[model samples]
Target: MRSRRVLFAVHDWGLGHATRCLVLIRALVERGDEVTVLMAPSPGLQLLKAELGQQCTFYPYPDIPKPLGRSPPMFYAAMTGALPLIWARFKREHRLTERLVRKHRFERVITDSRLGVWSRTAPSYCIFHSLRQIVPGRSPAIERLVERGQRRLLKPYRKVLIPDFAENGGLSGDLGHDPQLDWGAGRLVYIGPLSGVRRQNVPEDIDYFFSLSGLEPQRSLLEQRVQAALPRLSGRIVVARGRLDAAGDQEQKGNATIYGYLDRHAQAEMLNRARLVFTRSGYTTLMELAELGKRALLVPTPGQSEQEYLAQFHHERGHAWSTTQRRLDIVRDLARAQGTTGIPQHATADSVQRFLDAIS
Candidate 1:
C-alpha cells in the first residue's frame, strides 16, 4: 500500500481514551501511514505525547473535565448545561480538523469517542464502544432518543468501529444496552479489545490495588478518604492518584503504597503482580482488567451513570465486583471474592485497523 495520512481525533474524557489510542496510532504508523493525533491539550495527552514519539502530530481539541455533583441526574444536568461550550469546542476543533484535512490531504480521519471529526469530504470512520448515551433508569423512550442521536452520529462516518467482542457486547452487553442499538447493517465491526499491555505471569502477591482517577476534587477527595481508611486495609495496598504533573514513582505508606502515576508498562507490571485491582468501572478499564485476567473491586464515581451502569453490568455477570464511591468498605468484602474472568486474551483491540480498512 502506498503511504497515506490519517488524523486520529481522540476524546479528552480520561486517560483510557488516549491510552488505548496509543496502540491504534502506533499500528497505523507501523503500517507506513502518516498519523496525527488531535485532542484537547490534556495531562493524559501529555502522557501519550511522551510515549507516542515525535512522528505523531499533536493538535488541540476540546477537553472536558469530570463534574462534581451528588447524583447521576445532577451530574448529567450539570454536564448538559455545558452544551453551549461543548458545541463551541466541537465547532472550533472541527474547523481545525478541516484545516488539517485540507492542508495534509489526509487519506482518512479516525475519531475515537470524539464526534464530528467524521467529515463527508474525507474518508472517515468512528471508533467507540458506547452508542446509546448512558442514563439513569432503563427508559425505552430515552434509549430511543439516544439511539436516534447515536444513529445520526453514525451517519457521517463510513464505518463504526467497536472495541469489544462481537458476542454479548463483550462485558457490557446487558443492562438495557445493545451494541447493535444504532449500529447500521454491515457498518458495525468489532475488533476485539484494544489493549496495550498483556497479562504477565508476575507475582500476584499484593493485596488490593486501587487506581483512583477522575479529576481534581473527586480524585483528591477519593485519595483523602482512602488515605484515612488506609490503616484498616490488610496486606499490601497500592493507591495510584493518576496525577500528571509529578514524577511517577513508588512510595510506601505504612502497609499502603502510593504512586503519583504509572505509564502503561509500569501499570501492567503492577496489575500482573496485584491480587485485586480497584478503580472506576469504565468500559475500557473493564476490558483491560479482563484481558489481563485480574480481579477488581470497582468503585464508580457517585454520579456518572455510565460508570455506575458498567459497574452493575459486570457485577451481574460475575466478571468483577462493584461498590459506590461512598461505601468503599465493600472492598473489604471484595477481599473474600475469588477471581471470575475465565482466561486472559492476547488480542489487541484494533479499532484503528478496522477504521483504516473501512476507508481503504
Candidate 2:
C-alpha cells in the first residue's frame, strides 16, 4: 500500500454523487494515500476543489446529468432519450480507464457509479446504490434486459463497493436496487452511507429550509405551490431556490422568504434553523436529513419510482411524511410532517464509519 495512487471516478448527475465521493476521498487522503479524483466539472466539483485543495489531483470524467424534467414520467423519458449519449460515454469510459492505469501508475480505482472510469490493469471498485433494477413493470422483459446490461457493465471491476449496512440493507429495501444484487461474493463490500458534508451550528428551534431540488419542472412547481400555500401557515418560512444565479436576499411573499441558492454553509444554516423541513425524497437527501435529525414533509417527484419508494420507506419508519408532489396540500402535509419524528442523531457517525472501514 506504500505510495498508493487511488483514482476516484464520480458521476455528475447531481451534487449528491460527487459530494458523497468527497467524504470517501477525504478519508483516503487522511490515511496518507495519494488520490486523484476523476469527475466531470460540476458545481459540486468546484466546491470540492475549494475544500480539498492540493490534497489530491483531479481528472475530468465524461459524466453527464440525467436531464431535468418536471414530472417523473417526463424525467424518465428525458433520461431515456440520453441513451445514445450514455452509450457513447461508456465506450469512452473503458478507453480512458485503460490509459489512466499505466500513465498514472494507480494502485486503486474507486468509481461512484461511473460506467467506465476504472482499469483492467488495476484493482478497480464501483460504488453504487442499485444492484437490482427497479422497473415499474411497464416492461418486465425490458427490466430483465436492463439488469443484464448492468451486470455486463460491472463484470470487469475488481470489486463492487456498496453503501449500506451489513443487514437490513442499511437504508433501503431488498428487492429492487437492494442487497440481493451483491452477488460478487467476497468481492462485494457494504461501505455504509457515503457523504462528505459536515453541518455546522445545527439549530434546534427552526422548522425547515424548504429545499428545491436541482431537477426541472418539479422544482418550479414546488416553488409555485409552496408560495401559494405559505400564506395559510403560521410560522417562519425560508426557501432555498436551488439555482445559485437565481439566488438573492430573502424576498418576502406573505409569510415566506425565498433565496435563489444557498451555499453549503448557508444551507447548513437554514437546515439548522428550520423546525420542519420540506424536500423531495431523494436517497442522498435522506443522508443529509439523517444528519440533521429534523422532521420533514417529503414530496416525491411524480413517476420517479425510486423517490416514491424512498418516501414511503421513510414514512413507514416514522422518519418523515411522504406525499406526492402534485397532490400536495401543504397545510395537511405539514401537520403530518410535524407529527413524525426525525432520524436518530447517532445515524451519521454509524454510516460514515462503515464506509471508512470498508476501504481500510
User: In TM-score terms, which candidate is top?
Assistant: 1
Tens-digit lDDT track of model 1 for 1-360 = 887889888887878888778887887888888888888788768867888778788876666444556666677788888877767766666677788889889878999878768665787888877767666777878877877877886687777777777776475564223643645577777766777667677778777777888855567777777778777778888878777665467788899888888767777787778888877777778767867777777888778777888887777777777778776774464664455562235356454566456657
The TM-scores of all predictions, comma-separated, are: 0.91, 0.89
Judge candidate 1 at residue 154 and give its lDDT: 69
RMSD of 1: 2.5
Deviating ranges (above 4 Å) for candidate 1: 64-67, 174-182, 248-250, 339-346, 349-356
lDDT of 2 at 1: 43
lDDT of 2 by residue, 171-201 (tens): 6553223432346667666666654445566
Per-candidate Cα lDDT values, in order, are 0.74, 0.74
CA-only RMSD, every prediction: 2.5, 2.6
